[model samples]
Target: MNQVWLRVAQLEDADAIAQLVNRAFQVERFFIEGDRINPGAVRELLRKGKFLLAEQSGALAGCVYLEPHGDRCYLGLLSVDPGRQRSGLGTLLMGAAEEDCRAAGARGIDLQIVSLRTELPGYYRRLGYEENGTAPFPASAQPKQPCYFIRMSKELG
Candidate 1:
């Protein structure tokens, strides 16, 4: 396995982050329309929380967003570079995000996956997260097929 350096993203990384996220989220194109996020959105999110990034050979390999909310943290956008998917980068990023949440005094982490992504729940479950509930898919997403969000959460030990 190659060494991957982890760090909190900076403002200048917005473009790269957006590109990486868009590429990683292309799998959702079957149901969702367009890119997952833009550089402006990435900058806005930077103000609310932090993006934990994984770099391999100084290139973005993966990223996960962590927004601490009271005693719980909202985790999202766990993106692993498509070319690097299944290389354990997603798991690596998730572990780092969970640790960051714990250090920030969060009791648990919450995340949601599109209902159309039938493979997600099992992947998250392997990381100790359980299905909590569901949320309506944003109308703005303009999904091609009917879908909702499957909310999942994990309590930090």
Candidate 2:
């Protein structure tokens, strides 16, 4: 699909991104830290210059979060609009995020997906991510329900 590809994110994108995230995960929002997610935190996340949005015909098709993790970077909130799935947009965004990280000297890419989302881990594996086992949750990083998220990582080229 022909669309605008950019990493521009303003405070205004927060609500839209939140809505998209809410719809994408729904009952699985805990894994997303949705309970802890708000416009303010979204703004901070975006301010790090990692969050990105995909726009098609002036509307957002997907959103992603790429928070820096010391030498590595963390990929989270990889949500695509329900209507926009199966269009290769997610893969496109993932590539862009990975490329950006590589350019920034990240040794690897880290991710945390809910263990319950068995299909998602497999999906990441297909994209070259490998399971590194359950990662610890900082007492302040997120909520309690998604306590034992599976950690995955991919070494950058």
lDDT tens digits by residue: candidate 2, 1-157: 8766666567888988877776766656545454436677787888775677888888888888888879999899988888888798888888888898999899999988766676798788888999888866566755545566798999997
Evaluate model 2: give its TM-score. 0.83
Which ranges of candidate 1 are over 4 A from the true structure?
none
- Whole-model lDDT values for every prediction: 0.94, 0.80
RMSD of each: 0.7, 3.1
What lDDT is obtained when candidate 2 is compared to the true structure? 0.80
Which candidate ranks first by lDDT, i.e. highest? 1
On TM-score, the candidate that comes out on top is: 1
Model 2: CA > 4 A from native: 27-36, 136-147
- Writing each residue's lDDT as its tens digit, candidate 1 over 20-97 gives 999999999999878999999999999999999999987999999988888899999999999889989999999999
Residue 123, candidate 1: alpha-carbon lDDT: 99
